[model samples]
Target: MFYRIPSLGGLSPFVSLLSLALLAHNIDAASSGVINYGGDVPIGSKLVQVHVIYRHGDRNPKSPYPKSHYHDLKSWPGGWGELTDTGILQQIKLGILLKALYGPQNYGLLPEEFNVKIYKSVTTDVDRTIMSLIANQAGLWRSLKGKGIHEPDVQWNPTPFRVIADNKYDTIFGQNCSKAEKLVDMFRDERFEQLKNENLQLFQYAQENSGYEIMTHPTQICWLYDTLTVELLRKGIIPEWANALYPEPLESFLMEYLKAGSLTEEMRRLTGGPLLKTIITAMKNLTMGKDTIKMYAYSAHETSIYDVLAALCSPPKKPPGYTATLLFELFQYQNSFFLRILYRPGPDQTAFPMKIPGCGEQYICSLKKFEEITQHVLPKDLVAECTV
Candidate 1:
């Protein structure tokens, strides 16, 4: 966690001093330390650039399910409906926080300024996601108004943020399977059938058990065939060897197989489940698009976040909000673009490394250094923070 001198006055001096000492010791472990984000910004201005992936504010379920497995949206104290009164209040307060932090002039935004050019795209899910997008933006709109920016020309266009329900979702293992799948297909010719036959045992069970989902077992299959086989050849799981092989197909899933233990651990580490690349693609599109976009917001489930990180082959550290919102600032610097991550603690409103159920607010993880497109993959030393 990035340790900070207390900005509030509630703590006693002695407590503060002790906290400071402990923070100094732990800061290096959690994060190297906040980068002085001065030089890296556009034109070297320390102006803030924000990208937020927020959950919809408090709201009722879209509809009552006759036999639902998830939590009841109606049971949320508010009627079976849109954002509750409290939710609107929550979003409005967030607006206040935004103006306070980013400052109105930073983005040339305004309070009473609801008309800012904010480009927004949301997943085409049910009401919660769509409502959350509307409500969260409303919060910012209200907040922007306080800063003199009135109701902005908010656009809620549908994007490919949602999973494309097809054979691919039910199939495909590891990340970058689009590339991996191509690699696998190269061996389909008759000349490689002999080699394919050698590996047929690996897929034999799936073919026999037609009901079995090979895609569901992508990591396991990759683990047994790829990582494990490679480790067996080396006779040990050394870090250097692991790193070299991780770029190969199915390696990401293989690593997970080696780490699995408790279900809780699975949930904790499985922040980005499957659809990682889609999120990255959407983010990239937003930045490159011509919308004069001030803020780009994503309202998705926890799995969406996890999958995006995985797809990016990003360091595996996940965001911290319950319905965490991760803000990424896409800045064009001297013909290059740099991304900065701002994590918001959520549904509860906190920042990273602070402990909240299903949230890790203790530290902020950024690829600010690795976020450069040229250095998409991380160096060895930074491996611990991410799965990639």
Candidate 2:
């Protein structure tokens, strides 16, 4: 007998294992969860557009410890902060699945299987994100070239795409938040400008390691940097930046800042100012693009996801995964255009209860345009186990 426990952040190894086993068991099309293309989905409805976001897949997390804590990559099996062999396989499998779902025949393309307007992107942080995209692209490129369908393809195409985010999402947010808060606190301590000398190392670290260029724009300096300083002043955490009321607890402050849900009002006050402007522009672009575009894809991070969602005025919740793409598919009915949202965890894999607003049905597969077919094919047993 199998038992279930509350999954850690909705993903548990036991659940993953059980779901895979159940999925394998119900691969036959006749099964309940099996997707029989002709029967379930209406034949005439075709997919016209698509958008996706996903995590970079499994990789070693950056910084397993606080500044005061000491540990090294050698402590782990594969050395510090690197993708495992299994992570490589995960990307490869994702590519193969993408090819199967959006093959030449499905997309009605000419050059090959992946001969569509596909824009690929990655972060320059480490080899993991780049390699994962490379492996995934390999499957698509090979499938399009008709090279090694049954076996692996060694050939590669020379194509470059947009890949951003050199700094990990958490790292960027954490550093910026900490610095902002610390700066504000220093101002209130009456130490004014003295705290800058005290935490010189932190400022240097932020410059060297934070992966963002220090802005010289006076507004940004105050908006992004000094606003944080101002918040610190309000908190009375620091003594006016020149003199220290107490020793700057940089290590302790940074440690607490990096953890999930650690972003507080102070951090939000600083970060939110810039994001509000960005969100407005993004929303405007989407609205204008909606007139002609059917699907939109944003190759962004969890912070981006949170930004967009919060822009839409969503409640505070975690955005999962690196490649987690948010899809906004506009459904055109007789006289109205309704927006349908899809959240993809990976290639052709989605969470349960996918419903397109106008479709009137859940788990609809025929409308493959902007849909992850993997979910419709997942058996009930698999779904049950997956939810564990």
Instruction: Indicate the residue-level lDDT of 170 in model 1.
Output: 26
Candidate 2 per-residue C-alpha lDDT over 1-388 given as tens digits, one digit per residue, 9 for 90 to 100? 0112223344443223222211221122123221223223233434444444444555553433222112345533454445544454455444444444344444321124333343433344456566656655554445223443332212344345445543213221222344444644543232323434555654444434322232221111111232223223223432244122112343233222222122443333233223333222333344456323222223334454454333333322333443454544333334333334445443334422245432454433222332232222112222122221
Q: Candidate 1, which segments miss by more than 4 Å at Cα? A: 1-43, 46-49, 59-85, 103-112, 121-123, 143-291, 312-323, 347-388
Poorest lDDT segment (10 consecutive residues) of candidate 1: 354-363
User: Which structure among the candidates has the greatest TM-score?
Assistant: 2
TM-score of each: 0.41, 0.43
RMSD of each: 16.7, 16.3
Give the candidate number with the greatest lDDT: 1
- Give the local distance difference test score of model 2: 0.36
lDDT of each: 0.37, 0.36
